[model samples]
Target: MYSKTILAAAAIAGVQAQSSINSTSGYLNYTTVTGYFLQDLASTNVSTFDYTATNFGLINRTYPATAGLKANLTQWQQFEAQVNALNADAPLNTAYKVLFLGRHGEGYHNAAQTFYGTPDWNCYTSLLNGNATASWFDADLTPNGIEQALIAHDFWAHEIATQKIPYPQSYYTSPLTRCLKTANLTFSGLDLPQYYPFVPSVRELLREGISLHTCDHRRSRTYIHDLFPTWNIESSLTENDELWNGVTAETSDAQDARSKIVLDSIFSEDDHTWISITSHSGEIASILRVLGHQSFSLSTGAVIPVLVKVTFLPSGPPPSNPPYTTSTHCAAPPVTSIASLAQGCVCSGTAVGGITTPIFNISSDYPTSAGYQATDLGPVVTSAPAISSYSY
Candidate 1:
């Protein structure tokens, strides 16, 4: 009788031990899967005084240099705080996969040249210094552009080395030259292998006046099929269309297609552990919107990673979308109005400590030491991160 009891006790202990091991392994797996996006920050907020209803003037007028500066500064601070919080709240074994979205650094194009008014053929001229032979779509990154890519690359490298997130398995870019250059520089800086699968189909919808229905054509579907030969692009497209209205040439449609492509690629293959994509702000913003993020803007050289959790059970349907939610802690800061002055100067806080200082130091540095000392640092910098105009 005592032997029987002892045997039962041993069996119970073994089962408990096995369950504990499985639980630990599951936890470790959960921590390692993450996705990220980075973008060139553009100020979208416009002041009431400067409001103009015509020609998206509302969006263009609010440059990072002027009224929108303070908002951008606040957004970055909030985003960084969210990142820190996620690292803290997640399990110690969790790792991350980063997706970076950015605008090509400053180019030769005139800022005043509006996309709506400018001809597509002429678009390349200002951007490419009138060199017709040069490929406008794939132009080289400007000097400052390279610097921006390095900033993101260095930050990610530090995070991966110290935080234990896996290096990206693939790097994707638009067919455009500038985007390609940015991706190459980033991968080279990180010392990672390059895997380029041209996604011209992704860019098709972004072309001047393509319709959502046209974007969904079999030809477009075929292109996706070729890029990801094993995945069912058609089915994914169908699903996305159902969820986000039909796919059109509109920025919103392009975003839907891109997000679906990404999701399908990740789920289709088990071998690929991490992926990274380099694309524009409009597309990135759309993806973020679909993922339930309210309004988080991407800054130049900034990277936003979304950590999605998934589970495939033996007896249940796969969750419609991966269990992913962005960190709500990264909410944008409250808006503050600056009093307009007739002649005196207004200054926002300078970029310091990798985080924008809250207090805008509005002071004039004059020759006289006494005058310089007396100058007051104005309101904090609230400008939005510099975002590239999609029209370009």
Candidate 2:
């Protein structure tokens, strides 16, 4: 099934070599895998939900204004630097995949009449509503929510078994029950065994509407540390300490820093690895934007398994007289087909006898002029070609 054919009666081709070019030490590579959004499945206009005002608190005039504040420039720079470093260290064929940003399916907030009944109220009213009675970080997944996690698990498991795509080597999660539950469900199906860490800096932001008690924070830390001893909890959540009362530290800045550290540690050149992260929609979207993808949405059951490939070229002189630069490409596996052959199929047109052949067949036997029968003969069968075109 594999052969190289060249039909060149007359053809012209051009190749160029540039002697001077700046050789960058590294490049940036990333991909965003969007999870299933509940709003999308409901067929409701997400624009109406006002993510800026409701989920993100960006549009709120009360305390946290949305657009005026500049992103922490220093942290942003470090984040970018880490990405570039990873690109440099990654193998020529390395690809990065980011996944699991979505809402918890059908929660108590959605079931409560007082919460969902009010329009212009936050979609995440369970956290907001200023109700101390509500659980802050450890909200149990509703029955439907568990089903959503299962759906994501099924999708990921299928990808691993059929496509030979590696399961993530490391795991990360927000300190929220729903997020942790989602991670558990996904890891349950995969064969890989690895530890995961929970970053409270990222998780605290998701708990914006909920009042965080010291006890809650302590419990959350212990839960994650038990699973991942190497977790950087002290660095991640130290800002909550009374010692740093005067210093101004934004959650966004902390998140940016944490992402840099985590990404750098997880991605390596030795072996093919996958990393899974379960986090809230807001934090996931923010991380995606930081990674150079401006448009990404997370749904309840949505699972985005990003495929990131990294490559490095030889380092050369400065911009004045540059050296050869390496290139990298990032792509998500298609949602429709996970099989290895189908995954690699790309169409190129080269007519054998001024006729193009179908890339895929629905059935082995195509109806011929003589009769309907299965035949392994060439395209021309029973004195005539049985088919003209096919689509998958």
Winning candidate number (lDDT): 2
Candidate 1: segments with Cα more than 4 A from true spot: 1-104, 107-139, 160-164, 189-248, 310-392
Candidate 2 segments exceeding 4 Å error: 1-114, 117-138, 193-219, 223-273, 308-392
Report the C-alpha displacement of residue 224, candidate 2, in angstroms.
4.4
The per-residue C-alpha lDDT of model 1 at residue 115 equals: 28
Q: Which candidate is the best by TM-score?
A: 2
**Candidate 2 lDDT, 57-112, residue by residue in tens:** 11112112112445542321222233334434444334333233444444444344
Residue 172 displacement in candidate 1 (angstroms): 2.2
lDDT of 1 by residue, 135-199 (tens): 22223455666787776566656554544444555445443334545555555545443442322
lDDT of 1 at 392: 13
Which 10-residue window in model 1 sums to the lowest lDDT?
A: 11-20
lDDT of 1: 0.32
lDDT of 2: 0.35
lDDT of 1 at 249: 26
